[model samples]
Target: MTISDILRDSDYSLDLLEKHIDDLTIFQKEQKSGLTPPYTVCKVRKKEIKLTPEEVVRQLYLIKLHKEYGYPYERMQLEFAVHFGREVKRADIVIMDKIQPTVPYIIIEVKKPKLKDGKDQLKSYCNSTGATMAIWTNGKEIVYYHRKDPNYFEPIPNIPSQNQSLKDILTERVSIDDLIKIDILKTQRRSLKNIILDMEDEVLANAGVDVFEEVFKLVFIKLFDELQNTRKLSTHLEFRNYGESDSELKVKIEEIFAKAKKQWGGIFNDDEKIRLTPSHLSVCVSSLQDVKLFNSNLDVIDDAFEYLVNKTSKGEKGQYFTPRYVIDMCVKMLNPQEEETMIDTASGSCGFPIHTVFEVWRKIYKDLGIEESHLFTAEKKHERALEYVREKVFGIDFDDKSVRVSRMLNIIAGDGHTNVLNLNSLDFSRWEETTKDESWQDIYFDGWRRLKKLRSDKNSDKSYEFDIVMANPPFAGDIKESRILHQYELGKNASGKFQTKVGRDILFIERNLEMLKSGGRMAVVLPQGRFNNSSDKYIRDFIATKCRILAVVGLHGNVFKPHTGTKTSVLFVQKWDEKLCPKKDDYPIFFATMQKSSKDNSGDKIYVKNSDGSNRLDSHDHLIVEHDLYNHDGITQDGIAEAFLEFAKKEGLSFASGKCESPFDEAKYKALLDGLEVIEINFSEVLIDKNIRFEAEFYNSKIGLSDNFLYGDDIIDFV
Candidate 1:
């Protein structure tokens, strides 16, 4: 039986989906007529069935899951039907072998605001259908039911975490065996509910809302005592334990978590259980899933509170979660391994670390059949990579809450290493102090130990240090104050400090180098301001000489959330020995740009084919939808990879040929262009080519700004 026919045969999800489809149809029709239709409830009859865009999205996710698992829809039919004769709908989604059709292997019920009791629905459905296994899911929370006897269903523990895609499932990128061993499936509802409740109690107790608020206050007050003297929380920030019955606050918090779930690549239906309200003592709990204790204890209570307060205040924009696609690209390009030590200096929400961890896990498990016991951990049962979490991964953030969140995220990703520390990048003293002390002796520690060690090392002319460093630093500062921006700028004197602008981005580059060993690779997100800006010439020149600029990938604005929108670029480099002074051809720079193309001439059209001419598009296009880069192709999209790979190859070729330092030679480059014309023109022309390169002379209005270079008293320039 077809999926549509099966689902329609038994459940109400189809009806709900049909409602969405009807609305979408109306919306589409209105758009065609240049009209804006008002939002209204839409209904459709079974005979005139249509899938809503939302339903299509959910189906796509399901399809992706199947693809990962190597299961084709042809072999599986999704069955939805009602359970007990209460006219109650249940089993929103069920997977059965199309051949059998009568017996369902698995059943899933998704609850929304309109369809509550998703869990109960699944229970009833399993009893009625005799499905072997049933899942009641609301995205964030899922409860699994296994048949104990033919008539009864009992919960099972330790199902592996869902892979989120079909490919990951099919390849066993994350093991189902491991999932069964860990009893992840069993951890649902029971454990999750208890944990959430305890967490809520703890949060409410602290921050004048829960039992631990006082402890958290004490910790913060002590840590930032000096800043306390200057700009205390009581002074600059406020602590409010919203009173009971604050429905608005609850709604607001729910909205926030909902958005966060969507942004983080987790899906939530309307029926998902969420509670947002201040408790008796006033600590508010707003959760996307049902109430559960946030992992807590007095010692970690402050950390939790800090995360909540900061996360709530900063919201989604502050942490700036990097898109999975962008992170995927970085991981693919760098190919982070278990042996290499990786660090993200400005890890906001620890997105890179999470992505890196999973990517690394996939590689390790695929080849060696190992699973991460914790972030950076190796299972004793199987052969694994090197031990010592601290040696493998590290991250730093200026925000204390970010550090806490990063730590928890690392733990979740199976990395035991929790090295995220709090310190401002601009504060040289703080940066030095934090990195030097393995114990990380808090704010009182001296910051110059590392600098002293560097000065005392006997082998100053020797080998490289770190493997890779990656970051996306803050980018808002002027270049006038050399001292304020010393770490980022080129130095004037021989003794201490690098001269820099007041901005933070350049400082991150310099700091990234300090973290790297010679010949180490690095990938960093930068503002386009670095390119073509007169002041940045020093940095660019320094990079040209000291490092191999392997690739420069220009990104679209709005890659970050709309609020944090800024045109950015990712610069991939390999630091080399300055003393060796390799030939220009030894390390040519690769440049790639993602530009808008006419609807008919998109680069993504042929993006599936790689250099070897193999189709790489078969891998999950997780980046496309997660990053919101889709453009009506009805397929997952990634247009930037082709250009990036092309440029990377060019850069490698230039290095191999030993002829990279030639002056900007347009004539030689022209021949290299495959029928693509390089347009050139002077100022005052009204017309402009959309494909013009930003670095091109004609694109620069001031290149030959003066009429003549020989003398100031030149004739009037032509109009």
Candidate 2:
């Protein structure tokens, strides 16, 4: 039977994808087959692939290639094999030249996102087969590239159609305007990151300017060019030839750079020239000019920025970008709504703040009556949606380079910059010079004025303005400089004597709390030592005395990856308000411990795959990579976020199940059982209490696994 026919029970989850692939269609009829067990035929090789979820994705991509791109059947081969270093591996699909059957034209990866080296994987396949193009897709996202040379893969906005030649694609007219029209459906179809990395290897090494500064300037010019050409798709950033001379392209790029600087003054100097030689500049412009940077999902931009910054400032400065997955979990659980102010004190690349802007934008869009289906991709909504970002969110950082990067990211998300200041948030006294400088008046003064209203007092000690705050401060450093140390209450003895030293995060805990007004909620990442160390009893006491602790979730040691192995937890707190805090005698708080850390001990990310060893994909036809304390792809019952939500309902915890003592539907979900005797002994708490007496806490924690529970259809509905 076909998968649709076998799915009569409706027991299986149809979509593990958090995002959708709206651009492509997969016909149910095309997916069904007449084999004995019902397998689908590959359009390329005419071979039967078993009708599993992963195979279904492969078939759809193949159809897109044939119908949309007009790839000839004779040119294609399925299960194409290629050598990877010493080992030989078979790829999903490979397209060959009809004239030269031995020569591979394109290599396609239809495997779910689990294929770690998407670019490198395709590169090796090309090295073996001599394919000129590589495409990777999990159905949610697709990456297209031209294997420019053995060492580089250039990002092409779109691949050529059946009739178009490789030369035509390389030399086609490309405009900044074509990139501004946001196509929401193409969320996963982007990648110039590897291409930029390739550029570094190819020409940037010998470029006269700093690699980061030059590339950043080029990107800035490209973005501004698009902004100026908004909604006008016919305008082009094209050059006459791919093999242009250095001097000619230099003049043109310099003109663009000068204009971009004039338009956006703060980032670049007016006299800043295109440090790249004309030939190199022409190649970069041709490679990047066609792609829409703003339309790409924030993840793509984030990845590129991470690569650039890691090569330069972040590593030496003790700054690391917070993984987007962790940021998503915190945002989801907290659920920031429209009009509520949010800030990130540490704000490394401003991940917390930028995402907050997105969440708020989403809420405000729904409030203004935009359909959820069209929200992300709709160009009409971009300006309307970004207003909350400019008005409500804020950030501060100690590093100037980090501040510049943070501002640029915010500028993209907001479509303009807001209040991302270059200052030491902990050293509030030094903040005056930063805020008062004449050079920073336009960028700083207005936002500073607005932020100043948030302060509880004139002195920087009490700025209780923001309603919500989220931060992952630098953990590897301490405040040895007693000058900055004296600003915090943590820096003093009981008699008010200055302490010699203190943990930087300890001071930040106090600083972040001060930034919040009464009843404002905040989430911060702190070391495990704060929670368990007897030596730090005062820190815990300080937290208890200042705020009502909401929830504490232990994070995997690998969350910060290749950076630090320190065990950390996210502590959610709401500052004391007269109603929710001061008057409360006692309240039960939610407690959780993360079970499945989707990462290995070595800090390498682990992905969810199938029993057959193929990577598992979500409903979006994209690979569902799990990186948090839980898995959220809907393929596993391992989500700690979902578990906590369920627990909140049961325990009548605040913010989850309406009010503190509300009733819970304990039997929300029930596991399916096959033909077996059903005792239903777990139905009663009294019967469970008797068995619980003999069970150790650790033993009970594994209840859903082996002994005392059936092998299949284990504990369901929290019974």
Candidate 3:
């Protein structure tokens, strides 16, 4: 049966709703021939009932809340037919699972769709019953009110219900700790043994130096042993002197790599086959796997007998790890789901990847109610998150150390197969044969396959094509020895391209764009100069033409503490389709400045400056403010960043000030003075607007101020 039908039944007594009901706007319906006994269709009208149902539902919720809480609505008196005090009304049905009808535990006021006095009537009823909780609803939305004390019915959240059971209401009041005893974070931490074992397996299989080192050293010793018997000038005869010549060591390392490659099938292929020689073993010792793992104090034995290598090979550029909070904001904006394949081209330390894991974990456990234990390594958790590491995540970096570190970090974070590649992005040798001349072809190919797999069509539906890309590429970084830029046709003519003197940072931007599919979104940290310098025109034009800028966050100089003092700006852009660009001849772009609302004892509120030089500020010089920073708000130490982003979303406008007209136009002034009689008058004061005037009183005192003001036309040479 419908709730209204049961409530309107003649058998029910509304003594439970007496005081809270301010006015009853009742409507009458004609009694049909087959109608039952309960038919009270009396039209009732009253004040405080003008609000629509939606408004009524919201107000009713406020009525039950305590005063100290966020929204309290019970303070207002309930208006009744007798006229007691000011009335606050709520509408519809109320749930009172805790109260009994016979004892009058609580009361709720109900109102029909057209009834305006529902809240007033509910208030009066609350006063009459002295119940702590009350409710009002208009069927679609419901509100609950609870009294903190006898005098008030404070509004509380109307918990969604299937059946109004006391257990359900009590459950709502229980603390989160009461609901779940296990601490997911603490459980993961306690599983250090499993994490360490996993690390051991991973290091051996992937970065696992001991296994590969043993394999490489065995091959090395066997090759030398064979060479000794064959009298083949023993490859070992080449560089027995280790400490003397670094050059010889390099040449020996290269020769061994060559021999190792030849021993394997000549070129790197889809087949998982690798060969080793003495040089290969030595090179492995110098590889990133050897150095980082060998030095780790994770209680694992390091076997140097197996050619320990720690060399950060080709494209293994070191990258600074962006902080967690920064990644939080960036990833939140990117919002990648498990279904989405994420790619971080610069992939520094895999902060975004780690953040992605946490984000997915939150959604799976908290939002999806997938149980915190399911996120644990417990038996049930493994199957649910097993596929997450390999196909779900992708990261590429030129740094081999980054690849190893990123891979391990993810594995430790519970995703085993993190797709991190170590190769130079600038090298295209693997894609085209002409690029074979490159020295690091194998490393380049490793990265190329990873990139291709990321942008592949098969995975298109799994995630948005590069739904989010984020990075803080090097600042004023130069690539004097880049093999990638050397081959680019576009790099030949462009001013910022292919110049060794030009910063590597400039190239990274171009590379980042290439990595992104059209219409993809990106938030990259860059140097402040990129926003205004004319030298960056090529890059700026590319950004404007290719993408829609969502916002730019100007961070404070402090954001990079312990790092360099270089000021940074985050440019949030989404790859835009041509259809999305604004029409031509639109007004200059506008930015809304964001400022901090509060300050510390120092009185410096962190603020950012928009590129346009405007600010949302009471004062930038004397006072400062910091807004509650979050991924949603685009928080920066500086207030200007939010404004810059807002400006980008609007018209494509330059924030630079227009050049001032030359105040001393010598030639024009001379021409005007020669052709006409000129009169000069000096004024001490210049009035700008109502209530604002600029005055030089010394000059005004010397020459009495008059109504006539001096104009260029009337000016003549005078002392």
TM-score against truth, every candidate:
0.47, 0.69, 0.39
Give candidate 1's total backbone clashes: 60
Which one wins on lDDT? 2
| lDDT of candidate 2 at residue 644, scale 0 to 100 | 47
Weakest ten-residue segment in model 2 by summed lDDT: 669-678
lDDT of each prediction vs. the true structure? 0.43, 0.62, 0.40
TM-score, model 3 to reference:
0.39
What TM-score would you give candidate 2 relative to the actual structure?
0.69
Tens digits of per-residue lDDT for model 1, 1-719:
12243233232223212223322332222576674422322221122233433343245334433544444554344436555666755344566644576676667655331123554455567677776566554332344454444423434331223333222322332222232233321223223223333334334333343333322322222222212222222232111112224455445444444543333221123344342233321232212111111111111122244344443534433335454456666765665666666767788766666566655655666566554332122132223522424346666677665665555455333423344545664454445545566555542132122223332133331112556677876665444555545434344322334544345576667777767776677889887767545456656666656676666666656565433556677888777754322434333344444443211122121223333322232221111122222221335443443333343444443222212122333443433332221122222221123343323232223343332111111221111
Q: What's the true lDDT of residue 659 in model 3?
A: 29
Candidate RMSDs in Å, in order, are 16.3, 9.7, 26.7
Q: Candidate 1 lDDT (Cα, whole model)? A: 0.43
Candidate 2: misplaced stretches above 4 Å?
1-163, 173-193, 225-259, 286-292, 295-297, 372-387, 459-461, 493-497, 583-585, 600-623, 627-719
Summarize candidate 2's per-residue lDDT along 1-719 as a digit string, tens digits: 44445333332222323222243233333424533544556666565555655566666666667777888777777777787678888878887876788777888886635334566678778877778888876554565677767765655555677788777765665454334332212344335565576566556876766877877877777666555554353266532234345477677667777876665556665677777766567557655665555542355456567667777767665567877777866765665766578889999788898877766666666666765431142233456576667667888888776777777767766655567887788888777777778887765675677677777886763576788899988776678898877777777754566789888888889999989878788889887777665466567667777887766776767776665677777888778887534534355454455545656777555657675333565553334456434345456544445444554455443345422223444553112111111112221221122234322122114222222323122221111
Which stretches of model 1 miss by more than 4 angstroms? 1-287, 290-319, 369-388, 431-464, 477-488, 491-501, 578-581, 585-588, 595-639, 642-719
User: C-alpha displacement of 44 in model 2, angstroms?
Assistant: 14
lDDT of 1 at 671: 39
lDDT of each residue in 204-252, candidate 3, tens digit only: 3444244533434333323322233223334332312233233554455
